[model samples]
Target chain A: MAQRAVKQERAVRTREALVQAAAEVFGELGFAGASVSKIADRAGLTLGAMYFHFKSKEELAREIVVTQPARVRPEHESEGLQHAIDITLTWAYGLAEDTVLYAGARLVMEQEQFNAPEENSHRQWTDIIACDLRAAQAGREVRRAVDVEAVARLVVNACTGAQMHSSIESGRADLPQRIEEMWRVVLPSVAVPSAVARLEFGQSRGRRV
Target chain B: MAQRAVKQERAVRTREALVQAAAEVFGELGFAGASVSKIADRAGLTLGAMYFHFKSKEELAREIVVTQPARVRPEHESEGLQHAIDITLTWAYGLAEDTVLYAGARLVMEQEQFNAPEENSHRQWTDIIACDLRAAQAGREVRRAVDVEAVARLVVNACTGAQMHSSIESGRADLPQRIEEMWRVVLPSVAVPSAVARLEFGQSRGRRV
Candidate 1:
């Protein structure tokens, strides 16, 4: 049991190192330009070690694209829909804790490498968000007539644009706050008034924290 | 006098030719990779002539960044806000414009180029859109108290995302219609109810028409 625990911890460490190194390489060289060898070199691991952790570079790229630990966790099903969005964005922000990740996200998003299943797995985010919308509507947390698919697409697009702007902006003071403000304006359209009140503390937009 | 007029027109033609060439080069090579000699070559102009018309490559980039002559004509102003949006989107679709512009716009928005007037000039598009939003609101075409700036930014982002998606999706039959539908939802927010009813007389989201 101890041996297995040690192995698991080592695997986590190696996986994290690979993710950090890959973010740097992908950010600098871009998705098309980055190579597995370069990422392996940056990670201070052999190519074989990388393959041990990930089946291929595409698998690594997809993990980076989704950037959400919750998706990998078994307990996501227990979290409420809004909580899930909040968790995913927080995870995305956490992945961006490495400064290189901020740039990597931009490069990957711009290049938009979609052929690989790992990279394309980012689509799961939209579907997840859409499912959340459906759940919200079913629970009377959202409006009945709201088109969940469109809302999901728009939410993804808006958050993407907002995140890109946050990273690229020169004097961004509290970008997360700014992004949350965007959510405030958009949420009321689909949200239960009670949820909005709870999130807003009963204050109007531009007034709430 | 006629000889001078002929010279001026010739100069104008050469200037326009260079702009088109610069845009093409920028499109193909991206801003960081594009150079003046290549642009001049594409324009079928001597390098010296290109230099004579534009002082430097950066100047040409700035010009291209701000120049949307197809959408920025005086007629755009006369059409009023809703019609201006229609004309602008029509021009985007008409040119079969590339989504590469979003990358260009992203670069322009970086604001990392310091406080140079030329660099700041790229913000003209944002300002122009904001102006349109204000006009739209003042005309009672949109809801009051809405954050026009945020919505304007969202509109720009949504359009960019759609353009990029359409480029990748080979059977782009309904992509243009999707864009139009996006506008339908957006424009109604700004126009008065009666006007919204008058303006919106099509399928809300026509499939790839």
Candidate 2:
């Protein structure tokens, strides 16, 4: 049991190191430019060890992309649920321009390093956010008229477009601030306006968005 | 006069070489990954000549970005006057993935690499479309209640998002078809239902949607 624990610890460390290196490589080189050799070099790992943990670069990238939502706080999640799905999505919007998030996103786009299965898996994970929005609409926290799938797709696209533009066009404005404002604006279209007002005024203190 | 003509010729060559090089580098390395040396090498030119013309990497990138809208066929100057403008802009909905337009847009986002005054030019271009939509509404070509600006932004965002995602996601699905269909569905909100019908049926004459 002690030996098993030791191996597990080593494996976790290796994985952390790999993820960190992925952010760096993807941040600088984008998904296409980053290679396994380069990422391994960045992480100070050998090819054999990288293979031991991850079957391929795609696996590592998907692992990172799938793991990104962990940054959302519990409070944010519950508040979003109370108000509507946009509020929850807004929380993740904060991470749009994050180096780690960008890298992980690029990895999903990096065709060579990963394959179709990995890409579809990431797409499925992305669809989860859309699913949540649809559920909120079904719950009547969001409007019934709007198409939740399209709105969810739009939300992700806006997040990505704004993130890329914000990163490359810095000094013009604060990205996080802009995103929050956008969320505030777009949220009304998807949200139950009364619910939002209630949350805004603290009328529904115990409610979920 | 001869010497001046020769100088102009050299300048044109340099300019073309720079655009071609920037496109190749930007396409593969992404905006952040590309450098002056990489572009210069790609163009088979010395760094000095590149600097002589562009002065900075940002300048070269901007030059490429500004020339991108020609692909749109200058809807503003079309022969159909205001009606043509509407048709032209509408036609562009299907051309969202045009390489030239995407490249130009990418350059605008890479504002750090192309800090020319026109860096935020896309905002105005988008506004131009919005204004045109408003004009159409005012002219009774559209519905009075539609939010022209919102729909314009939605269309632009949808196009850009589709392009970027499709480029990476391959089999990412056809967004233009979806977007065009969406317009048909949404037209009743802003445009006269008859106009929407005309858009669908080519207006009884030889006109085409």
Output the number of the lDDT-best candidate. 1
| Model 1 Cα lDDT, one tens digit per residue, A1-209 | 99999999999999989988887887676666678999999999999999998877666676676664333232223333454356434534443454444544555454445344333323455677788678777877777876777666566555555554555443333345545655655675667788666542111222211
The DockQ figures for the candidates are: 0.29, 0.23
Q: Which ten residues in a row have the lowest lDDT in candidate 1 chain B?
A: B200-209
The sequence of per-residue lDDT tens digits that candidate 1 reaches over residues B31-114 is 656788998999999999999999887777767555553333333223335554654455345435433343244344333432
lDDT of 2 by residue, B1-209 (tens): 99999999999998887888887787666577789999899889999988888877677666666665444543233221144334434433423444444456555444554454435644545565677787677677866666666656444444555445554555334444434433433354456656655553121221223
Worst lDDT run of 10 residues, candidate 1 chain A, spans: A200-209
What TM-score fits each model? Answer: 0.76, 0.66
RMSD to the native, candidate 1? 5.5
List the lowest-lDDT window of 10 residues for candidate 2 chain B: B200-209
| TM-score of predicted chain B versus true chain B for each candidate | 0.73, 0.73
Docking class of 1: acceptable
